[model samples]
Each structure stands twice: as C-alpha cells, then as structure tokens.
Target: MFLISMIIWATALLGAVMTVWALTWAIKRGEFRNLRKGASSIFDAGEPIGRQTDFFPPVRKGVR
Candidate 1:
C-alpha cells in the first residue's frame, strides 16, 4: 500500500512539474503573440474565411 501511494504521489508531482514547464516554455517562445493569424493558420486562399468548403451527400442543384 505504501509503495502504491508513493508511486501515485510521484506521478502527480511529475505531471504538475511538466505542465508548469510547458507553460513557461510557450510563454518564452511567444506562442501567444498572434491571436488571429494562429486561429486562421489552417485556412488558405483557396478556402478563404466565411466560405463553406465541405458539402454533404445528396447535394441538390440550385439549392444553397
């Protein structure tokens, strides 16, 4: 029982440390500098904003 408890505590501590380290690294790397650009990074000229690129099956003509 004691061994299991110690392992659990150690794992929790490690997870907490990793989370803090990742957050600090991101802040130092300026990952949160660009808000809008990052949000639209996946979009390109072929698929601009406010444009529906995907269409479901059974698409009828002259039906938007």
Candidate 2:
C-alpha cells in the first residue's frame, strides 16, 4: 500500500515536471509565435482555406 502510493505520487510529479519542461522548451523555440500559420500548415494551394475538400468514403462517390 505504501509502495503503491509512493509510485503514484512519483508518477504524478514526473508528469507535471515533463509538462512544464515541454511548455518552456516550446516557448524558447518560438513555436507559439505563428498561431495562424501553424493552424493552416496542413493546407496547400490546391486546398485553400474555407473550402471543404475531404469527403468520407461513403459520400465520396456521390460528390462528383
């Protein structure tokens, strides 16, 4: 019982430390500087913004 409690506490502490470290690293690297660009990184010229290009398998054939 004591050992299980210690393990859980240690795991929680480690998770919190890792989360803080990751946030700090991202801040130092300017990862959050360009929010809009990052949000649209997956899009391309062929698939412009506000345009729905993807269709599910069942609805794909009927689209065209």
Candidate 3:
C-alpha cells in the first residue's frame, strides 16, 4: 500500500514540475505576446523572399 501511494505522489509531483517549467520557459520566450501569432505563423506572405525557381525551374522540350 505504501509503495502505491509513493508512486502516485511522485507522478503528481513530476507533472506539476513539468507544468511550471514549461510556463516559465514560455514566459521568458515571449510566447504569450498574442494567441494569433501562432496561427499566423503557419501562413506564407506573398512570394518567397529568395529566388525559388533556381531549384525548381521549368524543363525545356526538344532543346537537345
């Protein structure tokens, strides 16, 4: 019985510590600036900044 109780307490303590650590790291990294920032980051803004065609140019036919 004692072993079971100890295991439960240890699990609870570990979960609490992880929660606290994640919150602290997020606060330090400015993750809470705005909720939409996370969603917006998934989108692309117009064309890419660099030349993308360099890697994926169209192939010419009968050029050989």
Candidate 4:
C-alpha cells in the first residue's frame, strides 16, 4: 500500500538523520578520544560471582 511505503520511507530517513547527527555530535565533543581507557575497568576489580555450586550433587544420568 502507498501508506505503508510512505511510513517506511519516513522511518528510514529519520533513522539516517539521527545516526549522522549522533556521529557529528560525538566528533565535536571529542568522545572518541579515549578508545580503550575504561574498556577493561569493569573486570579490573574482581571476577563474576556464583559460578561454583557445590550445594547440589552432580547429575547422574544412569540413576536419574
């Protein structure tokens, strides 16, 4: 339908405009200067929790 096509075209145009605006803003604000400064800060403190579970016995396929 004509209405559906027009809606899709409008959406695509709006998305493209927003993406360009974001990139330009980032460049102007120097947000891309530090590429990896804080990239590893999340894992710098400690490992993830609750990966080990000895509370329950291991699965036995032959019995259960």
Query: Which one is best on TM-score?
Result: 1
Q: What TM-score goes with each of the models?
A: 0.75, 0.69, 0.56, 0.53
The 10 consecutive residues of candidate 3 with the worst lDDT sum are 47-56
Tell me the spans in candidate 3 whose CA falls farther than 4 Å from its real position: 34-36, 45-64
Q: Relative to the unseen true structure, what is the C-alpha lDDT of residue 28 in candidate 3, on a scale of 0 to 100?
A: 94
Point out the worst 10-residue segment of candidate 4 by lDDT. 44-53
Q: After superposition, how far is residue 22 of candidate 3 from its true place, in Å?
A: 0.8
Question: By how many angstroms RMSD does model 3 differ from the true structure?
Answer: 6.6
The regions of model 2 sitting more than 4 angstroms off are: 55-64
Model 2's alpha-carbon lDDT is 0.93
On the 0 to 100 scale, the lDDT of residue 18 in model 4 is 100
Instruction: Give Cα distance to truth, residue 35, candidate 1, Å.
Output: 1.2
Record all residue pairs in model 1 with backbone atoms less than 3 Å apart, i.e. clashing. none
Model 2: which residue pairs collide? Answer: none
- The residue-by-residue lDDT of candidate 4 on 1-64, one tens digit each, is 9999999999999999999999999999977777686464444334534344346777888975
